[model samples]
Target: MGKGPGLYSDIGKKARDLLYKDYQADHKFTVTTYTSNGVAITSTGIKKGELLLADVSTELKNNNITTNVKVDTKSTVSCRTI
Candidate 1:
């Protein structure tokens, strides 16, 4: 038996659409949420292929906005111009 890629929540679909509209990037990014030990967390964006985190971080720092974290219970989109 094999598993399939899951569907996105309403918020996740909106976020993905907004990212695509704003960034005009070719890759499709998906957001996922999960709980570990009763802690809820969310992750947006995708990792660069063949790039180390350090390398990607440095590149983002140089060309993109510094990372920011926002806490919200409802769905919202936060973005920065690259």
Candidate 2:
């Protein structure tokens, strides 16, 4: 296949879509914010909840693509004031 104007763009879009789908199924929560830097997602329920922060960075050059994805999860803690 020959490189075209939208080659990298297409790849990027597909990657994003797939990531979103997997994140939703895994977390059962919607992404609050999405940007070139990263995404923030959270879930809350009666039993327990969690917050997920992911940093996504991509670089494309010379017909090569590099993607970095880092995820951080924080658990919710219940605290009582004494």
Candidate 3:
């Protein structure tokens, strides 16, 4: 009952290692979009595990809202508003 014998203390650390520890990871993902106002957005990612997003094309590209997002992958996200 007291600290649960330290079993949960290392859960976070173990989870981090299990998710981050990688050797020669391979993954590919791409996202492309064209705004109604002639704006274009493109993103590509290549890393470990299967790609969740790839070659995505969207029609309506105007995101001007505040929100919270979380991603658990080794990739790059570049956002440029026009």
Candidate 4:
């Protein structure tokens, strides 16, 4: 199976929701980490049909780490309209 895509940030969330309304353009993604219950939290937002990293690359790119990864996580229902 293929991995997923995401936009990552060290601090602060992407103020604007991520979504690509145009089919002609490549889809993009955004990722952020937040504090929750005294733990660090990471979230990813992706547009439809956008491909993130593949399963094979996840280990190599992330130093052999592959847990909590998203394979096909897309934006919430709100973004589906556009």
- lDDT against the true structure, per candidate, is 0.42, 0.41, 0.50, 0.36
Compose the digit string of candidate 2's lDDT tens values, residues 1-82.
9975866567688778877855534443333444454433333222223544433222222224333333334433332222
lDDT of 4 by residue, 1-82 (tens): 8976554662334342234233345455455454432323344444447455321111112344323433433321221110
Indicate the TM-score of model 4. 0.22
The clash numbers for all candidates, in the given order, read 0, 0, 2, 6
lDDT of 4: 0.36
Can you tell me which runs of candidate 1 are displaced by over 4 Å?
1-25, 46-82
RMSD of each: 19.9, 20.0, 11.8, 21.9
Model 2 clash count equals 0
Weakest lDDT window of 10 consecutive positions for candidate 4: 53-62
What's the residue-level lDDT of 69 in candidate 4?
31
Where does model 2 exceed 4 Å of error? 1-4, 7-11, 25-82
lDDT of 1 by residue, 5-72 (tens): 77656548877787776674334344545444332244434346653221111112333454433433
Residue 59 accuracy (lDDT) in model 2: 26
In order of appearance, the predictions have TM-scores of 0.20, 0.20, 0.28, 0.22
